[model samples]
Target: MFKGLGGLGDMTKMLSAAKEMQSKMAQLQEEMDNMTVTGEAGAGMVKATANAKGKVKALDIAPSIFSAQDKEVVEDLILAAISNAQDKAQAKAAEEMQKMAAEMGLPADMKLPF
Candidate 1:
């Protein structure tokens, strides 16, 4: 139908692709928010959960690790667990983004606007 308008057909296709990409990105964001990862430290004495966006959601500490004299150790374990969780979240997010890019015929390394 756009034959009379030079390049209009191409422009229309581009626009449609852009819109589809936008929608897919939005859906990916939502999925990332819901996806979670768990990380552990201190030989599983401490555990932390975070979403793909790197937001910590919960933490768990084995009661046995808690001691009046080892308070500093407990604190360190918690920090380590949290750091691990955040790292895993970041990795998962990147993996999902790469997968989405691949599915959309984009370069796997392309940095998408989140």
Candidate 2:
């Protein structure tokens, strides 16, 4: 419909693409908030759960790993589990973005605004 204008057509197309992308991004954000990843350490003795946005949601520790002398070790394990959970969450988020980009006919490796 934007026939007479030269660059205006391209601009219009860009604007349409931008709006679509914005809508997709909002949906993705909501999905990420609901998506979860779990990370474990010490042979699954400690587990940390995080959302795809890398927010730690909860943690579980096995009773066997609890000992007064090993308090520091337990703390370390908890930290490691949390870090692993965050890493997994980030990877998951990236994978989701890649999937969306692919669906949009964009480069699968394109860095989406997350």
Candidate 3:
């Protein structure tokens, strides 16, 4: 019970909270890996899918956009879509982290290395 240990009880509570937070962060990382976002380019002719961890998972291209003469354009669109997906993933990850921080009674803007 640490009744005689002044401030020890408070310290123990803080340590417990810290450990809980660390566990939550680890779980969030796993959830982020499973979360997915999609980005599109070329008027939706190209689409890119990425996980919240910023890993591209798949790409979808409308068949109509594919042409022998416009190969370069298609490539550019694909790149743009992928870049957009990554950006969205990053934003989503930041949003989730902010939410987690808030739930942990920390500043929403606090940056924690994942």
Q: lDDT at 27 for candidate 2?
A: 100
Better of 1 and 2 by lDDT: 2
Query: Relative to the unseen true structure, what is the C-alpha lDDT of residue 8 in candidate 1, on a scale of 0 to 100?
Result: 83
Please provide, for model 2 over 34-112, each residue's C-alpha lDDT reduced to its tens digit, 9 standing for 90 to 100: 9999999898999999999999999999999888999999999999999999999999999999999988899866899
Best by lDDT: 2
As for candidate 2, its clashing pairs are none
Candidate 1: which stretches are off by over 4 Å? 1-4
Error of 1 at 73 (Å): 0.8
lDDT of each: 0.92, 0.94, 0.93
What lDDT tens digits, residue by residue, belong to model 3 across residues 1-114? 766899888899999999998999999999999999999999999999999999999999999987899999999999999999999999999999999988889876799644
- Candidate 2 off by > 4 Å: 1-4
Candidate 3 — which residues are off by over 4 angstroms?
1-4
- lDDT by residue (tens digit), candidate 1, 6-113: 988889999998999999999999999999999999999999999999999999999998779999999999999999999999999889888888998998779886
TM-score of 2: 0.92
